[model samples]
Target: MNQDTPMLPSIEPATLEWREGQPVSARFGDVYFSRENGLEESRYVFLAHNRLPERFANLKAGDTFVVAETGFGTGLNFLATWQAFRDQAPSGARLHFVSVERYPLTSDDLRQALSLWPELESLADELCEQYPPLVVGNHRLVLASGDVRLTLYFGDALEALGELTFEADAWFLDGFAPACNPGLWNTSIIEQIRQHSRPGASLATFTAAGYIRRALADAGFAVQRVPGFGPKRDMIRGDLPPDGQNTGDGNGSILVVGAGIAGSLLARNLADRGRTVIVADRGEAPGTGASGNAQGALYAKLGVQFNDQTRLSLAALLHAQRYYPANTPRVWHGTGLLMMAGSEHERLRQQKFLQQNEYPDRILTPVSAEQARSLTGVPCPHGGLWFPGSGWLEPYRLCTTLLDHPNIRTEFGFRATRLLPCNNRWCLSGEGRQDLIADAVVIAAGHETRKLMPVLGEFRMKAIRGQVTSLPSGALTATPKAVVAGTRYLNPPMNGLAVTGATFDLHDSDPQERLSSHQENIAGLESMIPGLLSCDDLASSVSGRVSFRCTTHDYQPVVGALVNGDGRVLDGAWLFTGLGSKGLMWAPLLAEHLADCLTGQPAALPRSLARRVDPKRCLAEPVDTGVPVG
Candidate 1:
């Protein structure tokens, strides 16, 4: 796949309508059917027949079940199921509903249709708020305060089902009647459904046609005839026997190498879920990777129009700012951020975006160069967007705080040299053959992950060495109230020292601290803040540290499941690397996403943005030209 090509499935168009005073919905074009019965028809034919209330009774804390559906017109069946689950299940249990819909109704149409159920209004509102963009492929939405996850495969049911892998606890065969939609009821679709069913998985549908029963039986379901809900005479209900059980859940133990932000955050999330996780790194303590910087700024840049990268950055910035802790040992001064108008075109573009959208004016402001100087306590050639909520974070301190949770065990000075899969478990080996095993593993060792997984050797992840120079506060009479950005960035003085950086070296990988890069960084800062101080005086108080940042071809971080061996196996392993210079702004949210996928919890970020960070795409495609390289 080309880097520019979007990894989304195609969607087909279809129409839906509700039968007035009737409980049925009629889909037009490829499938046409009516809920000839009332809403009770859905309850009896879909819910009771599948024995859902009883299944809910069996759920325990942290338990999750998957439900697969053939059709999702109007989402009535989903809404009903969500309401039922919310009323019946235990507090901590989660439900994942995987539904396929070739054509999805507009938000307005959904609101109108759902208006028939006044009781479901609140849930309907949540759904509308998180509705996916009118695009194809899998779109995930979080509902009911993150307990109910909905993954909508908006495309051909058969093709989309083929792309999904799930162990469903129940199946809602709510597609149009067999006669109206034979393509959906065919044996091929039934077989695909059978592939995802777990042992004793029950299924319920409103149809009792002969071919439907025969096809389902042939596809592995033990079909039974049951009295239909409402006026319908009969319906089909049954269960699929268990295939084979593989221990994909890493409940026993796991080894995570790299104690930086990625590995430490992963450890915290896993430990919170009661999993025993050990975080290891070569350094004597955690956060010694690229995360050891004194301070890093958080901000998102937008291009002229909404492109893929721009959209992704916007979504990430929103999600991260909402979730990252507001109070920590590390200083979090909302010093805001200043993105100078380096060019006239950029200034015009920023102005246009501000005028078009009702974005938080408190977070962003347009000002003149003199006004920018007043706000930031520095001289600027041009004014640009000012983000008030933006600030700097002590990366090392935050990483250590995330590891402070009791469930997370840390092991320093243990560098992982090899990762091998043995007996359906991953074993990390190094240092005199000391090994630790786990049902699942994550490779977050920055650029070193490619070395461990040879299949990813061809990926475009590069290690760009960088150095940040620290100068005495005497260089500036007044500390900046905000971080200033243009060609370089300068943070407000902290503890009598102001940090400014960083010099980028694309050709270097060695971690050796270089004086030349430090000098260059000081020069870069002077260029951004002219008349601040001379290089000679700044160099006298300057100190620096070097680190390498992992970067992907597209500048987005790799944060999902790993694809290995010619796509034959989606190795239980995952990744959370390639954060590059945006670690402070992107890591917290990306780590939350990886945690959601692991715990089967609802993702906080948009599905489109999530795909941009999926680790599998890195192995499948070449470098993306969408990112701007400095």
Candidate 2:
């Protein structure tokens, strides 16, 4: 699962031309679908040949059917498959569709193309609503009221399939004609397709060329020619032998220690996948740890040097943009954010970060002082990078929502100080609670995670205490339209209060409110925005919260399976903490990853990038996330 990928390219939208109401790809010089019978063509070539209808109907409750596709052109094929699965599959069944697209249709274009079928309008509307920005990365969407999951990779098909980790039961080997877009049908792609296929997995393609059939056979699939749909004469379908076994690696009833963002998200993800999950916390409530901040900004601390940390941060930010809006948008906002130029050091970092990473303006765009003022009502001194889809949210409220799944249970005031093996399961017991038995356990209790490590004097993670003070909006002369951050952050007023300070104190664990911390926050704000806050701000009515963030010595999170002193993963134990101050940004995607590891599903990120956060990453090879773009 190493990600040796090139700098991600901004997706150039597919340009389309209308030919008698049929959409044709300008780049590939191919029709997206047949104007005559595209829907039936999809049903005939993919669903029927792949045996999805019969397979879907046979699925037991809690079963998931995985599908991968080479091209997501117009999404007609996917839509057709989705409808068929819902029609055939059991109520508790799930469909996970993974698709790769080099040139994605703009959301507007997707809507227009889908509008051809009035019957699919409802599902089409939902897809368009959750379609991600044209950024090269994985965009996973939870659709069909959680019955369908779509993980769309907006990148080259071969690279995505090569790096992507999933065992697909079926594959729609689709794209433009091989005569024109043969790269997708090349040996590398065919090999990756076979590599990712599950034993007895079926594949269907629109082409019936002899070489394609030969390649499929050579790749160990039982290949055959089939009658095509509509004007096409023939297609191909293939199945890998059952002996080609590639099995799942995750499972069992799980217990998550910690009710903060990390544990709650992990519990929720597992519960969504039908795993029984119990969340235990020392506090009486969720997010009452590091995630207890009154207001938390949903952004990342991007690096000036593009490294694994930077790549991870960038990926987390992009995934978060789609995740929050789709899952918790009601609890937060994407109004935008401005990281103002603060110190000479910070200004240089911002300039270098922009120059080294040439991302699309939608992800980051620089603004002038005047533009900054226009965007944020009262900003004049400096201008920096503008994160268009970043904002702040109530962290506790988000945690509460994530843990509300039907299959997830919660235990508050459950301090887990001892973990013991019992009958192939794990026993979690500590003060204030009885021993809880779970098939597996994940320690996500912030800094307290270190206390649970079996082979540890100290588990390479430390506590960094932070405090944030909230000032009522009535006390401020001006409020920003968006969140603002530099040395400190300023959130847009919510419920008549605009939140400001967060003193970063290293190696400290005091959880008490302090007047000095309040004064320091106001001082930093006044220094960043000269006239925005009165000097007497400390005297005005203000309240605050203090919490400890758990961070690794290297500052990456401790994710993946919990490893022992000899580097072997402990049986029935996993760790999902060490998010530091970026839990709001990191939890969404990393939680998806840890859940995959714990549940034996495909990983959300490749191991190269994931290794940065892996508990025993130093024992692994060093990560190289390609050169800086531009």
Candidate 3:
């Protein structure tokens, strides 16, 4: 939970030796798998013992089967299980495999290790292509067109597993031998494992150590020692006793207000989980609100040190990068991001931040002025941070694509006037059409959320107006290869055009294009890059758009279940608003969280972070100054 605390040294990549044409780990002094037949050994020890084939086959149309693993050593077990699910499971069922790894192998090393087994080559290649950078966080990978999802936790299992908030239907206890790695089989860890397992969860482990058996038994699992594969005499298999948790009925209709990034994503995620979704917006189409920006940077803006906000931003950034497709031609440009130190004070802050943290270079690399210029082709006056995984996205395109789901029904040119309850369900009524009824309702209407639901008035959502200017690509003598930000941002050329200047005005809701704002943008560019552009060159030809962004007083998004005036959470109403400026980076993961809350599944974010963004947070801790609504 202490995200700011320094991470311990990463796991050293396993050194291997060829023994009888089998891979042997030099560190653990154990074979990666049985020398006689590794693939068959994995299938028998994990799949057969867990009864995954039957479990997967029995899954209903909208059900999700989650499998958690202790170690993801060559990902051999994951690939075999994926293949089994592909062969045996229904098409509508989804497989969510969460694996924790201390030291991850390089892509080249993984390729070589997986090359030993040709049977899993296809799955191995897919995993290799999407393998995340060596960063210490969750990297969610959606494969096979969203049928299979893999969340790889790149850190020590002991620390990483505690951060995860998901209930596993099956567990793959596939770490090293208990005799060699006793830390992994400790009592506390076994208890944590039990905490994250759903009722009647099945578990499989190759080790049959008596200590581990006792640990599993004490942790509430009805464990049993069973026949092992190959030469091994016995393995451990068990099932956790049922724990009372509300598993929602699959057939529920929901209505989502707004069709921007937040609502579109929430609608799609719900639809993916087999819920009928209705997305209502006042615009002619989706992304006509704040998400209609031409080009927005997709990276976390961190402070000098990590805090709750920065930690949440980093998680959201990582999740968006992994969940959304970034190379969909005109949709997203994975050109990386550069944040410049425009002033001496900011330069000192950057230096102090880099000196205090030992982050992986892939996550954030402190670059010198020369390095920044060389990498981005922008002459940043001072050194800054470079985020390799950041990029620029066309929000309108992204939202439209997300709303293209089969289960999503869009109602454009319509706005809801009131939220009324009918027969325990919700009704969304407007002026033109008949009332729309649903089992649940989600309010994602940006700044108009608090206005629509008076109970949320305590959250005090503020509307911040922002304007972005765009110029012809040829206007600049040189273009940055990536998005460069200091006082303002300059995205790389898209469709022979480049965008700049998003001036933040807290109390201004004027949507008209302003020449003064364009001049300010040009000044901003001059400060970051001395000779990029001049006011005279772009003052006459620049085009810009303005939109209002919404945020809460504490700056955390108002997500999760809605709370009534009496402080009880409304059963079928949710709020997913107040994302402010971080919509592109934050929307996807928050959408996942909302979906979890709706489906009675485990949360995707930490509970601490979740509580911070809860809709009732403002009510729980009343602020001295009330929320402002204009």
Number of the top-ranking candidate, with TM-score as the measure: 2
Model 2 per-residue lDDT at 258: 93
Task: Please give the distance, in angstroms, between residue 42's alpha carbon in candidate 2 and its true position after superposition.
Answer: 0.9
Total clashes, candidate 1? 2
Give the clash total for candidate 3.
0
Residues 459-548, model 2: lDDT tens digits: 566798888888888767787888888888899888987888788899776789888888888888888988887547463458988888
Task: Rank by lDDT, highest first.
Answer: 2, 3, 1
Where in model 2 is the C-alpha error above 4 Å? 1-9, 243-251, 304-308, 535-541, 618-630
RMSD of each: 7.9, 3.9, 3.8
- If both were scored by TM-score, which would come out higher, candidate 2 or candidate 3? 2
Instruction: Please count the clashing residue pairs in each candidate, in the order shown.
Output: 2, 4, 0
lDDT of candidate 1 over 556-627, digit per residue (tens): 788877666344335567777998988777766676678767765545444456667766566544345342
lDDT of 3 at 304: 57
- TM for every model, in the order presented, reads 0.65, 0.93, 0.91
Superposition error at 100 for model 2 (Å): 1.5
What digit string (tens of lDDT, one per residue) describes model 3 on residues 1-630? 266444421224557776766666777898777778778988999999889999889877777788999999888899999999998899788888989887677666678878988988888888887887665566667687667778787777888777878889999998789887787888878988988888989999999999899989988999999999878999999998765774434678999999999999899988877789999998999999999987888877776566656667777887787676632445878788888888888788888777655666667788888988888886667768998888889999988988988899999988778887789899988879778889999999998887777364355569998888887888887878999988888999888878887888888978888888888888787777887863356766788888899988778888888776556777888999999888988898899888877876656766556766877665644433233211
**Model 1, runs deviating above 4 Å:** 1-57, 65-252, 326-333, 343-367, 370-381, 454-457, 533-536, 563-570, 599-611, 614-630
How well does candidate 1 score on lDDT at residue 27?
Answer: 52
